[model samples]
Structure formats: structure tokens, C-alpha cells
Target chain A: MYQELLTGLLNGDIRSLARCISLVENEAAGYESILEQLPGNNHTKVVGVTGPPGAGKSTLVNALITSLLEADKSVAIIAVDPSSPFNFGALLGDRIRMGQHFNHPKVFIRSMASRGALGGLSPKIIEVSDLVKAAGFDYLFIETVGVGQSEVEVAGVADTTVVVVVPEAGDEIQTMKAGLMEIADIFVVNKADREQADIFAKNLRLLAHTKHQPGGWEIPVIKSVAIQNTGITDIIHAVDAHHKAVTGQHQRQLILLADRAYQLIQHKRMKDINKQLLMSEIQQLLEQNSFNLYRYINESSCFTQRGKEGKEA
Target chain B: MYQELLTGLLNGDIRSLARCISLVENEAAGYESILEQLPGNNHTKVVGVTGPPGAGKSTLVNALITSLLEADKSVAIIAVDPSSPFNFGALLGDRIRMGQHFNHPKVFIRSMASRGALGGLSPKIIEVSDLVKAAGFDYLFIETVGVGQSEVEVAGVADTTVVVVVPEAGDEIQTMKAGLMEIADIFVVNKADREQADIFAKNLRLLAHTKHQPGGWEIPVIKSVAIQNTGITDIIHAVDAHHKAVTGQHQRQLILLADRAYQLIQHKRMKDINKQLLMSEIQQLLEQNSFNLYRYINESSCFTQRGKEGKEA
Candidate 1:
């Protein structure tokens, strides 16, 4: 069964890719075999598009996909709103034209629900990105709501991060500067037709210039009216330029790959422990008059130390 | 060394408590022995105070502590700012009087630095809270910035959560309702002397009644001018009332204990893996033309599953 799915995914079957993602997301039996056989190295450029609420990130991403499509680049998008669970994408519902790309042969869009963990980004996101990249898309766009620690975490996954903001986002920009300054490679001053757009763009450029990126790529603040489809080509050009400039930066890639590996290892280590079993065990443990949590964890069979089996602890 | 510290901590020594927490946070060698010996069950109430920036959470917490002190109850405060990393508590710096409690015999406060992770709450916070609880304080206050997913997570750790908001927080209240509704056991309309404070308090009361909790306690909306120290007594009363209502809710506690245990297990499983080791390993792996992440995780010794030793995956 795993072999059939792996064969189809390698042969560019979209259904197989979707099925594999579901399997991984649910941690279905034998998912590792499918992940193990995936291609090792690929040229798929992962781009992250993130911004505050009402920042027109979706519209900007839609325009980005449209421009990429003009070049016949296969694009897959992963939409993960930082506030997605609580707000339920109420902000992105009308803004994202993701539904419009449903029947498009070259496009694949996946939206991640938080799995009830409001801890910014999901743990599986890095692993899922690896899986998605193996399907051989020319580019992958991970779009997310720029709240919590997501902006920084997404920067870890994406080759380039594009921060979308509007003319009225002056205050928000000031508040989010620490994270935005660290991660933003390309700044999109979306709704450039609005008042003070040029001023915001200039301020963003000043902020971007302060970051000493190891890849030696200069950050650019592009003014784009995504609603009118203007400046899409210029934005695409900026993405290409940044991509070219960072191509040979091996240490940066090494750091990114290592971070990804660390997360995968963390997930695998935590794979078998079940919450339901934990509940039943605790229910039994709490029956006693004294219930020391630390003692319980130390004595628990699940957490039994393999290396220190004979140690004094 | 662990035995001496554990004895001192059990005797209600403040210095020992601090030292012990440091050891746990650092995961010092043989620290598990200290944890394993902590008292099984104790009667200490953990209260969570969370709200948006400038909602006067620290002030409210200060007032709460002052009230508890009047009753001669020992208190420990763990202040975790959700946006603490980026802002560096620029908002809470002058607002929090954590320094004032340094000389107070009955009060202890610790501020978390987020470990540079902007993820809402740190995983160690739970274990640290357990450490604090074992010190035999009459009450523990966990004060956190109510943004991100913290408000909900804190609710899991706390016996009762007091959500503080100002009269001007109408918009933020609306945006944060989904999370706030689930977690808030008490609402503080702080800075209640301001205009529309009464209306906001009334609206919150209506909202609170919407939740159906297992404890069957009425969620109270308390009006407070925390700066002037008014309403502190009433807030304490509400907290006591909540403690009384939830006293026998065994199933509820079973869930909280299970959640805490699960996090402990996860941390233990992931304890041996190091990022520096991962980077060095990845550097070696990346030298080849291809390095599949899934293959690396599978073949790596750290994630070798004990239960599935003979399996194919």
C-alpha cells in the first residue's frame, strides 16, 4: 500500500500527494516508508508570505501565483494562519482566492488547521513542507497570518519571506518590527493606491537595510496594488533576484536543514505517547491520596530511560 | 546535593525553592531525583492572570497579591509575557512591580525570558509551575500576556483564570473572544472608572454565562480600579469561590494532570537530542549530493523506537 502511494507521488500524481499528506498529518501506519523513499535533493524554492490581519497577504499571494503561472511554474501553497484556529480564517475567507485555483492543473493549495495547539506554528509543518517539495513543484508558497512567533518560524522553512502590509499598517509595523526585521526578505506595500503608500514603502526599505543577511542579498520594499494586479511582475523579479543572490549560501542552507531535521527528530521521539492512555493512567494514579506529578513522570514506563537504566535516578 | 535542596524546599525555604527551580529549568544532572521526592498531593491554588497589553494585568496581579498578603497567605508569581521576547517587557517594565516584592518575605516572583522562542508559552512553564507548587505556597499566580494561544494554555494550568481588560478594549475583546470565552473563569473590567466600563462589564457577564463548564461555577465579572486598589478584596473572594466550586471536580483534574504528564513525557523523550549535534551530523550528510530528511530520521539512532524494534519502518 505504501509502495503504491510512493510510486504515484513520484510520478506526479496529485491525488497520491494529497493522500500521503493526510496519512502523515494523521500519522497513519507505515507513513515513514513513504517519507524515506522521497527524493533527497530538489530545486523547489519555498517562499513564505505572511502579514498582520487585513494586510492583503492572500491577495498578494494570489497575484504572486498568477505571475508565477505566466512563467508556467508549478506552485503549491500552504495556508497556515497563526490565528487560524480561533478566528477560523474569518480574515482570509474572502481575501484568499484559493478556491479559484481548485481546477487549475499546475496549482496545489493546502490549508493547515492548528490541531488545537495555539503554539504559533504546528510541529508537523516542517515535515509536511519536505513532503510537498518532493512532489516536484517549481515553487511552494507557505502563506500564514503574521502573529505569535510564526513570522520567525516560517523564515526558518522558507528560502525567502515576503511581508505584506498596507498604508495604514504604520503602527502595526512599529509593533512587529523585531520579527519583521529578522525574517522579511521582500516587503510588499500592498494597496499602493492608498494614501501614504510611498512613505510606508520608504520606511520599510530603511528598516530592511538594517538587516545584515548572511546571503548578502539586499532587501527590497516593493509598492504593489495587488487588488489591481499591478506590480506583480516587479514582485516576481524581486523574488527571482533574492533567490539568485542566496543560491550559493551553503551555511544558511545547512542551518535551515539542521533545524528541519531537529523538528523531525523531536516529532519522531514524541510519536507513540497517546493522550487517552495518559488520561486513564492519571485517573488511576490520582486515586491515591498523594499525587506528585514529578514522581509520576519519573516512575512512568513510557518515559523509562534507555541510556540510564542502571543510574541512581 | 539534591537531597539537601529538596529538604530545604520542603521546609518552605525561599532560597532553596529558587535554587531548585533553576536546577529543573537547566535540567541539572540528577534533578529527576529531586522531582521524584516532591509531596504527592498538596492544597495550593494556582490562579492565572492574563490580558492584552495595557489592560493593567500586572497592576491587577499586584493588587491580588496585596489582598492575599492581608490574609497572610504565601504567594508566588510567575510572570510570562507572551510578547515578552520582542518587546522585552517594554510594556510591563514600568508597569510590573516585580522588583518591589524582592524584599517582601511572603512574596516571590520570577519572570521568564521566553528562551528566545516567541511560541506563546514555553514547555518548561508547566514543570516550573509544578516546582513552584511543591514549595508549599498557599497560592501561586501565573501572570501572562493574553495574546497568542497563551490564555487557553494557562487555563489548563490554572484553577481559575482572570481575564483583565480596560474600557477601551472593545475591539480586542471581540477579536479575542473565541479563546477568551473558552478559558476565562473571571473577567476584570479594570480601570473601571473610565467611560463605558459599566457597559463592558455587563457585556462580559453575558458572554461568561454562555460557557458550560464541568465545575458549574458562575463566571463572575468584577469591576476594579486596580490602580487605586479598589475591588481587590472582591477579586480574592471570587477566586476563593472558584476554588470552592471546583474542589471536588476530579475528572477535570484528571485531564489537567494527564496534559501535564504528556508534556513531561515529551520533554523527557526529547532530552538527549542536541541541536549542535544535529548541525554537525547534517553538515556531514549534506556533503553528499542527496540527503533525504525522512531517511536520516529513520536511520538516526536517537529515534529508534523501543516498541517497534523489529518493524520495517
Candidate 2:
């Protein structure tokens, strides 16, 4: 069954691709067999669009989709919302914003919410993304909802990362968490028609310019009114420039490749260590004198020694 | 040095408690030693307060503090903001909101951020909460800034979890995420003086009443104007009622106790599996056709084959 799905996926069968993505995302039975057959490095330009919620990220993504369609490029978007676990309302809001792009044959949009998946969100996202790349697209856009460390994880899957912000987000310097500043290859100040937009854009440009970059790429700050269909071309230009700049850096590419695998491996390694077994062991141990939380955890086979050392000691 | 700190902690020394909290929050050297020396289960009523950003959670906490102080109960607050990684802006904001209680002899406030800790946040919080419990406070309040799985993890450490939401949050039925609904023992309609506050409060009451409760405790919904100190007493009453209702449920108590240890153990297990090492190994394997993410992860020593079946396989 999975072989048929994989062949269909590689042949650009849309229904097969959608079914396989859902299976991978949900980690259904036999998902591992499907993942094992996936090819490496499909050479798709994976652009990550992330920003604080209410920063017009979906609108920006919608406009970018239209622009990409105009340039005669096939695009697939993975709208990843980690916040939807808190509220499905935001996910619904996102769909409404991108509603117009649903019918375009050249555009593919999939919305994912981290509801049932607790410790597995990142791995599922990476796997589904790989499947999407295998299905073949000229460009892939992945949009995440928040600006926390989770956003940093999203950057691992993206070749070019664009951090979107609005005019109001500029008032407080503290709002731009350090992790967000470190990963941004391009900055889009969206909602440019709003009050204080000009000042916000200027301040953002200055901040991006002043931010120390150990790499050679100069981060471009683009002013965008995504709702008005303006400044989308500039963002495309910035993305192109970043792509060209980073393509020559072989070391950075390897690091990104490693990062993509890191989360998947870490999650997979942790999955077999059952929480129920650990909790049962802990419950029995709590009544004993040697039942210190730290000691017990440190002495676990994974952390310290295997069975031989444990038995000997 | 830690001995002196531990001695002061047992004797109810304030500065020593602050210093020890910093040490534990930072996971400094000898911190686990300090944790080991502390007594277990000091009978502190730990209440967790959590909500979305800009929901005025800190102000609600401030009002609750005043009520608790008036009751003459000595209190220690662990204001756990899992959002800020930069210079302690949210922590400072929380302190400012609770400024008046800073000098009170019976009140202790400490702020914790997720800075420098990625997967370690929940375990550190659980360990620190245990330390605060050992300090002989009548009550402990743990507050978190964002609505994510991290907040749910924090709820594991609390006796009663209070989720604060404003009037605007009541409009969408989809706004209440599943995990939040499950953990909420009490709900606060904060900022109840706004235009739609009354209707919102009624709607919240309906929503909470409709949710499933396997534990047989009716979740209470209280309205509060935290800035003006209105409806604060009702929240306290709700907490008391929840405590009385759940005290006899032995199974539930054991479940909560196990949850507190679960994260600590999981984190400790993952800590020794270095990402850079795994990534480099994965990079090497990616060149081989047989290299699969899931297969490689499964073959790792931790996940499987550490003990019983390895010799046979």
C-alpha cells in the first residue's frame, strides 16, 4: 500500500500525496516504512515564513503565493501552527486568510495543527515536509505562528527564512526575542499601511543593519502591505539574493542538513523509552531509601550505564 | 556553600531562599545536591496561573496576592514565564505588577524564564517548585506567560490549575484548546469591567459547564477585575472548593505525583544523547542508500537492544 502511495507521490498524484502526508503527519502504522523510502535532498527551495501571531503572516504568504504563480512556479505551503493546540480558533482564522488560494491547481496548501501530537510536532513536520518535497515543487513555503524557540526549529527545515513583523511589534525592543533575531535572513515589515508604519520600517531596517552577522549575507528589510498586494516582489528579490549568497557556503549547507536530521533522530530515540514504564518504576522506587529523583534518572540505562554495569554495580 | 544555603533554607531564611532559587533555576553546579537535601511534600498548596500574552495574568496574580496576604497566609510565588529569552523583561513586568508585595516579610516572589534551557524547562520547574515547597510556605503560585504544552507541563506541579482568559477570548468556541480545557480546575474571566464582560462571563460559564470532567469535580468560572480588585475573593473560594473536592481522590493524587517526575526523568534521559554527535553520525550515514531516519533511530542503543533481546537479535 505504501509503495503504491510512494510511487504516486513521486509521480505528482495530488490525492496520493495528500493521503500520504496525512499518514506521515499522524504517524499512523507503517509510517516508518514510508519514511524509509523517501529520497534525500530533492533540491526544492524551502522558504520559511514565521512571525508573531497577528503580524499578517498568512496574508503575506497568500500574496507571495499569487506572486509565485505569476512567475510560473509551482508552490506548496505547509501552514504549521503550534498555537492551535491552545485554540483551534487561530487555525480557522488562518484558513480564512488564505481562502482564496484553495482552487489554484498550481498552488498546494496544507494546514497542520499540533493538537494530538505532544512531544512529536517537530518530527512529524519534518517528515511531512520531506514527502512534500518528493512530490515535486519549484518552491515550498512553511509558515509558523509564533516567535519562540519553536520558530528556530522551523528554520532548520528552511533554506531561506523570512521573519515577518508589523508596525506595533516595533514599539518594544524587548519583543524581538534574541532567537528570532539570530535566524532571520530577511525581514518583512508587513501591514505597512497601518499607523506609524514608516517609522517602524525605518527602525526595523536600522535594527537589522546593526545586528551583527558572522556570515556574509546582509539581511534585507522589506516593507510590505500584504493585504494591499504591494512589496511582495521586494520580498521575492530578498529571498533570491539570500539564496545566491548562501549557496556557495558548503559548511552552512551541511550544518542545515545535520539540523534537519537532529530533531528526527532525537525524537525517534526517545520514543521507545516508554513513560508508562518509567512512571511505574518510579512509583515503586519512591518508597525505597535510594529513591532520589536525580539519582534514579542519572542511573537510568540511557543516561549512564547499560545492563552489565548496572548489575555489576 | 550549598550546605550553608540549605541550612538557611530549612531555617526559613529569605535571602538564602532567593539565592537557592536562582541556583536551581539556572541548574547551577551542586543544584541537585541541594534538591536531594530538601524535604519532600511540605503540604504547600501550589496554584498554577496561566494564560495567553496580554491577558493581564500578572495583574490578576497581583490581586490574588493581596487577598492571600489579607488572609495572613505566608506565600511564595514562582512566576514562571516560558517566553522571554532575552534580558528579563516579562519577569520585570511581573515584578512591577506585584511591586507592593515585594517588601512584605511573609511574601516571596521569584521569576523564571526558559532562557538557556530548551527541553529542560519543565523538569527545572518541578525541581524548583519542590524546593519552594520545602521552604515552609503556606501557598505557592506558579504562573506561565504563553499557552503551550509548557503551560500544561507546569500544571503537573500545581494542586489546582487556574486558566485566565479575557472577555474577547470568549467569542469563539474554537478558542478554547483541548489541553487547556482538560487541565483547568478553575477559570477566571479577568478584566471583567470591559464592554462585553458580562456576556462573556456568562458564555465562559456555559463553556466550562459543558466540558467533560472525568474527575467528578465541577470546574468553577469566576469573573474578576484584577486591576480594581473586584471578584478576587471568588477566585480564592473556588480554589478552596477545588482542594476540598479533590483531596479524597487517591488515584488522581498519585497520577499528578507521577506526572511531576515524568518530565524530569525524560529530560535526564535525553540530556546525555548529544545532538552534535548524533547529527555527525547521521551525516555520515546519509550517504548510504540503506540509511533511514527511523531505522537509524531505532537501532540506537537507547531506544532498543540495550538489554534483553540484543544478544538474541
Candidate 3:
């Protein structure tokens, strides 16, 4: 079954790719063998588009896809929304926003809910990204549901990260955590026809440049009105320029690889912990009226009582 | 040192409160002893106010504080923002928005960063919440920098969640994942003077009630121009009403306690798996041509060599 799916995946069968993603997402039996067999280090150019909500990310991606298709590039989009496990409706709006690209032969669009990871990015997303890359897409756009915490994590998985914003976000830019500035390769001041667009764009450019000068790769801030499909060609050009700029930055690439590896290692170590078993266990403990979270974890054998920090018996 | 701090903390010394929070946030030595000694399950009424940005949460929190103080109630607020670790400026805007209460001895305000949790919440917030509850305050308000994924997690920590919104969020509400409705105990339409405020409030009331009939709590949809301090009294009354509704719901309490315990256990188990160590190891592996993330984690001795899934030999 695995061999058949993989052959179809490499041969660009969409059904095969979808089935493979589902298998990896659910961590089905022998998913590890499939992931390990995927070809290593493809230059598929993973680009992440993220910003605060209402920043027009879906519209921007629709425009971006149009420009890429015009140049005859195949694209796979992983739209990640941090949603309720119960709410499968997260992607319905994306379908409406990018309706033109819904059935396009060269475009593959998939919406991934933030699967309740202890942190922001699901471990499955990294595996799915690799699967898509092995499927031989020319570009992979991982567009995130722009909010507070998940933006930086998305950057770790992408080669080029685009931070989108509007003129209304000018005040917020000042208070932004500064990590966004470091992660972004390009910034788009979308809805650039709005008031304060030029001023916001200029200020953002200043902020981005002041953060770092990595390999003299200057971060460009482009102004676009995504709904009108304007300034998309500029975004595509900037992406190409960024790809050229980071060609030999081997050390930086290694760091991102290490970050991904660290998350993978930590999560895998937690395989023994089943939350259902834990909840039932804790319910019994709480009835004793002495349920201290700190003390309980320190004494519970399942959670590091094998002893770190030398505080345990 | 902890003994003196505990005495001061119990005596309601503000300096001691700040120091205790820092100690817990850092997980300083023997801090678990302090937590173990603290009074268990003190009724401190943890009310979390959360919503999207531009929704006037801060202003509503300001009004909430004023009403609480007027009735001789002391309030401690923990503001959680998922900001960059590099940016300390996340709280500066909070300070200005909540300026009058900043220096008020009766009101204690603390800002908590997300601290780059692999998920959206820091485990530290739970510990800090427990610590503040021990310090003898009438109310503990956890005001989240609400955008997306973190909102539901905040709900798990809060006994009563107040989801604030604006008339503008009406469109986004239809597409919202059902989890928000489940978590919110109260919905506030802040900036009710804006266009469509009444219609939006009516729709939200419908959405909030349709999801569940929890103890017949009747989730109230409040329309308040928080800037004008209108409707603050109604929110306070609704909170009081909900408090009475949840009196003997021991099962619900047990579930929340278990959830918190689950997070505690998960983080504690991850203590010895340091990222810095993992990075050095992965950097070396990347130098070789065959570094599959899946294969490395599977074979890596630090992560699950003891083996639960039986996939490993």
C-alpha cells in the first residue's frame, strides 16, 4: 500500500498526494517508512505568507498564485488556520477567496488546522510539506492564519517568509515583538491604496532593515492591493531575488533544520503520554483534595520522575 | 528567602507578589514548595477577557477594573501577549491603555509573554495564576492579546471567559470555528456605537446560545461603548450571575483541573531534552547527505529509544 501511494505521489497523482498527507497527518502505521523514503533536499522553494488577521492573506495568495501560473509554475498551498479541532469549517472562506484557482490543474490547495500542538506548528505539517515537495511542485506557499504566536513557527519551515500588513496596522508595527522583522524576507503593504499606506510601508521598511543585514540581503517592502490583483508581479520578483540571495547561506539553513529536528525529537519523546488516560488518572487524584499541579508532575512517574534536576528520589 | 516572600505574599505585599511571579515564571529552585504550601482552590474568580485585536479589550478591561475598584474589590490582571522574546515593548502599550490603574495599590497588573511555547500558551501562566490566587485578591483577570489559536487555551485556564468583539467582526463570526462559542461564557460587543452593533450583538447572542445549554447560564451578549464606560455594570452583573450558575458543577471543575495537569505533565517531561543540544547534533547530521528528519528522530537515542509504539526494534 505504501509503495503504491509513493509511486503515485512521485508521479504527481493528486489523489495519491492527498492520501499520503492524510496518512502522515494521522500518523498511520508505517508512515515513518514513507517519510524516510522521500527524496532529500529538493529546491522547491517554500515561501510563507503571514501577518495579523484581516491583513488580506488569502486574497494576496490568490493574486500570488495568478502571477506564478502566468510564468507556468506549479504550486501547492498549505493554508494553516489555528482552529478548533471540532471546527472543520476553517477553509470554506479560503475556497471562496481563491475560487478561480479551486480546480486549476497546476495548483493544489490544502487547509490544515493547527492540530492543537503544545506549541504553534503541528509536527505533521513538516512531514506534509516534505511530501508535497517530493511530489515535484515548483513552489510551496504555506499561508498562515495571521495571529499572535504561530507566525515565527511558519517562518522556520519556509525558505522565504513574506509578512503582509495594512495601513491600519501602522500603530501595531511599533509594538510588534521584533521577531516578525527578523523572520520576514519580504513585506507587502497590501491595500496600499488605503490612507497612510505609503507612510506605513516606509516605516516598516526602516524597521525591517534596522533589524539585520544578513548577507546584505535587503528586505524589500512592496505595496499591493490584493483584491485588485495589483503589485503581485513585484511580490513574485522579490521571491525570486530572495531565492538568489540565500543560495550559499549554508549555516542559516542548518539552523532552521536543527530547529525542526528539535521539535520532532521533543514531540516523539512524548509518544507514551495519552491524554485520555491522563485525564482519567488526574480526576481520581483531584478527589483527594490535594491536587497540586507542580507537585503532581514531580511525583508522577510518567512525567520525568526518572529524575532530572536531582530534586526527586 | 521563599519563607519571607511567602509571608509577604500572604500579607499582600506588592513587591513580594512581583518577586513570586518572577520566581514561578523562571521555575526557580524549590518554588514547587511554595506552590505546594499555597492555599488550594481559593475562590479568586479567574475571568479571562479575550477577542481579536481592534476589538477594544483593553478599554473594556479598564472599565471592568474601575467597577471592581468602586465596589472595594482588589484586582490582579495577567495580560498574556504572544510577542517576540526580543521585544519587551508588548506591555508598554498596555501600560498606557491602563495608565490610571498602573499605580493604584488596590490593582495589581502583570504582563506575561507567550515565551515561545511550542503551542500557544506558556505553562508558566498556570503557575502564576495559582500564585496570584494565593495572594488574596477578589478577582484575577487574565486579559489575552486575542487573535486566534491562543483564545481557547486561555479558556482552559479561565473559570469564566468573556469573548469581546466589535460590530466589524460580524462577517468573520459566520466563518468562525465553533470552539469560540463553546469557550465563551460572556460575549461583549465593545464599541457598540459603531455601525451594525445591535444587529451584530443579536447575531452573537443567537450563536452563543445555539452551541450549548450549560447549566442554563444564558451567555449574555452585552453591547457596550467601553470608551464611554457604558454597559460596564451589566457585564459585572452577568459575571456574578454566571458565578452562581457554576456553584456545584464538580465534574466541570475536575475536567479543567485535569487539563491544567495535562499541560504541566507534558512540559515537565520535556525538561531534559534541551534544544541547544539537539541543534548541535542536528547540525552535524545535516553535513551528511542523508539526513531524513523522520529517520533521525526515530533512530535518535534521546527520543523514545525505550519505545512505546513498538515500531522500533
Candidate 4:
């Protein structure tokens, strides 16, 4: 089944792509086998959009997708929303916001709930993005349910991270102070028709001024009323500029590639170890307080003897 | 140093208590050793207070602490704040709001930042709470940085969790609809002097009427203006009543105790294992993407073979 899914994904079957994402995101059985087939077929530009809740991120993403489609590009969006604690499902309000685009052939949108996952991105977000890429989307956008710092971490996983903000949320300084300001390749002031838009833009620029870049490129703050579709072209231009800047840095690209490869390998191995470690028997021993995790790690035969000697030393 | 600190903590030395919390919150060198000394001293009651930002949580906590102190109780507060990404220090606004209690001999207030920790409880929060318990506090209040749903996980680690909301923000249905509503042991309608207080209270009562509690206890919604100390005593009484009820249930108490013990032991072992895993050579291997973490775990001889076999089977 896993091999068939991989073949179907590589062949750009949208149904296979959707199934692969569902499998990865839900951790369906045989996810590791699917993941093992991914490394060779996973080249895609992943973009992350994140901001405080109520910043019109979904609308902005819809606008971005429209623009991308205008240029004849296929797009995939993984929009994350907080799950309803009672029902354990996506709130679906975000889905309603993008209802108009539901039937657009050039766009595919999926709503994922945090679902007891820690940090902003689901552990499988990267894997799903890979599947989306393999499905022939020219761009894949990951939108996080922006609560706070976790959103920043989720944005960190993307190749180009766009940090969205509102004009009068009193979070302008807080966002800049939160270090998210530094990570943003593009600063989007959404809901620009609201009062204080100009002042917010000035503050963002001032914050950007203080950020020292070796390449001397300034972070551009674009004002967009996403609901009205204004300033989106400028936003797209800034995104393109950032993509160019990042790809232009040959050394940074190599470092990023190396880091990603390392993470992929680590993730694969950790999933295997975690499956073994979190087994019911081990959990029972842990619950009984009879199992010592340190001792268990040291004595397990799955590891090399060099690791054993290192632990002893 | 850790042993001396532990001894000082157990002997009820206040400065040692403060310094130890600071270290744990900062993940300083000796934090793990402090936790290793903590298990037998787990006697304090932990209560978590969480709500939307600017819901008057800090003020309510201050009022509660003062009321507790009037009864001659020693209190420890762990105020979770969003860390400044630049310096990795707390934003400190929440701590500043409770500054008046900082000098009180019976009160220990420590500000903890999320510090990008995925688990709602910082790796250090559990440890610091242990030290605070060892320092002989009768009550420990953990006030989390109010993001949305994630705060519920922090409340899970506490004995009693209070979800605070304000009048005029929205109706009771909206409050309950918010993710943290179900996590509440006590619902506090803070700023009750506002015009919408009665309506909010009514909505809460209506919702509470529909809730089926297998434990046979209805969650009470109390109205309070923390600035004026209105209904402050009632809030404390309600918290005490809930705490007593939960503690008096033999099955629930055993479950809580068993869960706490498991967490304590697991955390301690993970710390030790993490230390052994971070040795210089292993770090080098990890950097090179050649360190098989599973292999390392399997080969460590310090652990029992049964634990290893359990992992495999």
C-alpha cells in the first residue's frame, strides 16, 4: 500500500497526494514507509504565513493564491486552525472564509487542527508539504493558527516566512520584540483600511531599520487590505525578492540543504525510536515506576557499541 | 552546589528558593540535580489561572495571594510570560503587575518565559514547583501567558485550574465556546462591575446547567471585581472547596498521585538521559548526521536489560 501510494504521489495523482497527506498528518499505519520513500522526491519551495489571530491571514493567503494562479501557478495551502476541544475537529470558520475559492482548480486548501500537537506545525507538516510538492503544485503555503510564539516556530520551518500583522492590535511592538520580526522575509500589515495603518507601517519600518543584515537588504512592510485585494501585487513582488535573495546566497543554500537532510534523517529515526519507547508495555513499566528510562536507553541492543562506550564515558 | 541548594530548599530558606527557581526557569547548569532531589517533597497544592490577555488574571492572582496570606499561608507563584526572543528573558509585564507582593516574606513570585518550549509547562516549571513545595509553601499558583487553547495543557499539570473571563468581552456562550472553558474547575467573571456582568453570569449558569458531571459537582461561576476585591473571598472559598472535593475522592486522588509520580520519575530519567546524550563526541556525531539515537539508547550499559527487551517487544 505504501509503495503504491508513493508511486501514485510521484505520478502527480491528486487523490494519492491527498491520501498521503491525510496519512502523514493523522499518523496512519505505515507512515514511516511512506516517509522513507520521500527523500528523493521532495523538492519544493515551502512558504509559511503566520500572525496573531484575526489578522486576516486566510484572506491574505486566498489573495496570494489568486495572484499565483493568475501567473498560471498551481498552489497548495495547509491552513491550521485550533481544534474544538469538545469535538476534536477544526473550528471550520477558517474554511468558511475561503469558501469562494473552494472550487478553484488551480488551488487546493486543507484545514488541519493542532490536535494535541505541540509547537505551531504538526510533526507531519513538512512531510505533507513534500507530498503537496510531489503532486505538482508550484507553491505550497503553510498557514499556522497564530496564538503566539509557537506560530513563529512554525514559520521557521518554511523557506520564505511571511509574518502578518494588523494596524491597531497593539501587537506591533510585541511582534517585533518577539523575534518574529527578524524571521519575516516579508512584513504584511493586513486590514490596512483600519485606523492607524500608516502609523503601524511607520513603526514596522522603524523596527526593520534596526535589524542589521550583512547583505543590507531592508525588510519591506507592505500594507494590504486583503479583503479588498489591495497592495497584493507589492506583497507578491516582495516575496519574489526574498526568494531571489535566499537562492542567491549559494553558501546559505548549501547549509539549508544540509540542515534539512539532517532533520529528515533524524525525524525518521526518532519516529522509530519513539514508537518503540512509547509502547504500552514500556508505558506500563513507566507507570509502575519500575522502569528507568536512562537504564533502558543504555542497555538497548538496537544501538551501536560505540554509543554504549560513549554513554559510559 | 545543587545538593546545598536542595538542602536549603528543604530547610525553608527563602533566598535559596528564589535563586533555585530562577535557575530552573533559565535552565542553568544545576537545574536537573535540583529536580532529582524533589520527588519526596511533593506536598503543595498547585492551582493554574489562565484566560485571555488583559483579563485581569494577574490582579486576581494578587488578590487571591493576599487573601491567602491574611490566613497566614505561604504562597508561591509561577508567572509564565512570553520570552523576549532577543534576550530569552521574560517580557516581565505580568510580574510587574504583582510587584507589591514581591517583598513579602511569605510570598515567592518567579516569572517564567515559554522560551519556545513546546510543552505548555516549561521543562523547568515542574522542577520549580517541586522546589517551591520543598520550600514549604501551602499553595502554588501558576499563571500562564494567555494564548488560546494551549493554556489548557498547563492547567492539566495542576490540581485545580481556574479559567478567568471578563464581562463585556462577550457572552457566556462565547466564553464557554472558547477552548479553555471546559478546563475550568472554577469560572471567574472578573471585572464584574462592568454592565455585562449579570448577563455573563446568567449565560455561565445556563451552560453549567446543561453540563453532565460524572463527578456530581457542577463548576461554579463566580463574579468578581479584583480591583475592588469584590467576591474575592468567595473565589478562594470556591477554589478550596473544589480542591477538597477532588482530594477527598479516593479514586481521583490516587489517579492524581499516580500521574504525578509517573511524570516526576519520567522527567528525572529524561533529564539524566539527555545529559548523557549530549556529551562532546555525541554532539559531534549528531552534527554529522551519523548519530543513531536509537542505537545509542540500545547500547548504553547503565540501564537494565529488561527495559531494553520491553522496548523491543
Candidate 1 vs. true structure, TM-score: 0.85
Q: Candidate order by lDDT, highest to lowest?
A: 3, 1, 2, 4
* TM per candidate: 0.85, 0.71, 0.81, 0.72
Best lDDT goes to which candidate? 3
lDDT of 2 by residue, B117-228 (tens): 2333546778778777778888889988753345666667898999887766322233433446667899887878887788877876777787756567878878888999
For candidate 1, give the docking quality class from DockQ.
acceptable
Write the residue-wise lDDT of candidate 4 on B167-242 in tens digits: 6531223523345555677889888998878987898777665665447768889999998888889988888888
- Local distance difference test, per candidate? 0.73, 0.71, 0.76, 0.65
Docking class of 2: incorrect
Write down the C-alpha DockQ for each prediction.
0.39, 0.17, 0.30, 0.11
Q: Pick the candidate with the highest TM-score.
A: 1
Which residue pairs clash in candidate 3? A118-B119, A119-B118, A119-B119, A120-B118
Candidate maximizing DockQ: 1
Q: Write the per-residue lDDT of candidate 4 for residues A1-313, one digit (tens) a residue.
A: 5888888887777778888888887778766566555543344567889876667788898898888889988788887665545423233566777787778877778876654322222445556666687677778888886453446545545778888887753332443334566567778998899778998788888887777654566788899999899988998888777776775454444334433432333333233333333343344544453333334444555344433443432
Where does candidate 3 chain B have its weakest 10-residue lDDT segment?
Answer: B303-312
TM-score of 2: 0.71
Residue-wise C-alpha lDDT for candidate 1, range B1-313, written one tens digit per residue: 5888888888889999999889877878877777778887778899998866567788788877888888899999988754434555455573346566656888888876444331123567887777788888999998875345565567778988888877753233454454566677888888999878888888778777866778678888899999899899999999889988988789878777777776666556555555566777788887888878777766665433441232244
Q: Score residue A161 of candidate 3 by CA lDDT.
A: 95
